[model samples]
Target: NNPKKTGPTLNETFLGLLYPTENYKVYGYLTNTKVKFILVTTDLDVRDADVRNFFRRFHSAYVDAVSNPFHVPGKKITSRTFAERVSTIVKSFGLSTAV
Candidate 1:
């Protein structure tokens, strides 16, 4: 591996933590086209890698949802594929073995 690269490329999809609260924290990811994703969790000790993985998987689901030829632009996503993927991602949050 090239020593120059430390980790995954800073892909615009998984923007890190936005803010933290006493009981929980909120993270954000904003797409270049302005779609936004938010994740709030009570687990303050969660790792950045885990959060990144969550958003990356969620973003992939969103992308796949809108990739259909018949999908209308600007319409809300109701795809089952996206729903299932997101459900699994959310349920597996903070689990190192999830990936």
Candidate 2:
């Protein structure tokens, strides 16, 4: 039933070719440093431009975090401030999920 099984997976192809699946839509941005930023949204009507904007903002925040002299690169981000900043950014986009 999954169309992905009939063809190449996202990891096997270019990021630009990836599309939405049944239950969720995936958008990806691959950085020159090989860092991949992915966003999964349940709203199928979401436009590509919105996704691009989200990635742009996220990449900026990520860079700020990694650029800190005290922050180590390639390690799990454990900074509470960074986590809060990311959460705030996501919420600012009105993408918060309610249980």
Candidate 3:
């Protein structure tokens, strides 16, 4: 009944831990600064290289977001520009924006 609880609990394990559930694959990337990026995909054939590329592009967007003069570090991202950039990047990979 609590399927949502599993993801966060597994995420606490560590960076780079790929946790596979019955219908999805959860991938993780942790920066040296401890910023966690989690990617959940239903495509079983998704390759690690593609995941790495996605994270790289996402990281670039994240950097640009944080570099803004008005941006506050460690706070939730509320920038529309950053969201649009990330959505575009994700769409380029033929992935849906729902996630």
Candidate 4:
């Protein structure tokens, strides 16, 4: 039972962890295919506009992953490209600003 291969790796594909630290919040989404997405994140002080954009980008990533011919519906997403996209989304949480 290797930790790397333990359980469905979908949890990691979301954000590299099953859950975040204390004071975090959880969000959910239901895809057209009945796929449910739940994610936890530390309380963020991001702007409303940023939050919308963030979800949009995240959803885009998920769609791309599922669209992969090798991906099996309702199964763990093992695409390295998907994981890297998630990492990038989390890293670029917020960098743009205007006044």
- Which has the greatest lDDT? 1
- List the pairs of residues colliding in candidate 4: none
lDDT of each: 0.84, 0.71, 0.76, 0.66
Better of 2 and 3 by lDDT: 3
> Mind sharing the TM-score for model 3?
0.72
Error of 1 at 57 (Å): 0.6
Instruction: Kindly list the per-residue Cα lDDT of model 4 for residues 1-99, writing each as its tens digit.
Output: 577664434432232233445676555555555565665666454444454466668788999998999999879999999999989988877657565
How does model 3 fare in lDDT? 0.76
Residue-by-residue lDDT tens digits, candidate 3, 1-99:
676554435333234437988788888877656788898888777767677778878888988898898998878889999999998877776353557
lDDT of 2 at 43: 77
Pairs that collide, model 3 = none
Worst 10 residues of 1 by lDDT: 6-15
Candidate 1 local lDDT, 1-99, one digit each (tens): 677966547565766788998999999888867899999999999998888888888888888889988789899888787788889988988988655
Cα deviation in Å at residue 91, candidate 2?
1.1
Once all C-alphas are superposed, what RMSD does model 1 give against the true structure? 3.1
How many clashing residue pairs are found in candidate 1?
0
What value does the lDDT take at residue 49 in candidate 1? 85
Model 3 misses residue 30 by how many Å? 0.8
Return the candidate ranking by TM-score, descending.
1, 3, 2, 4
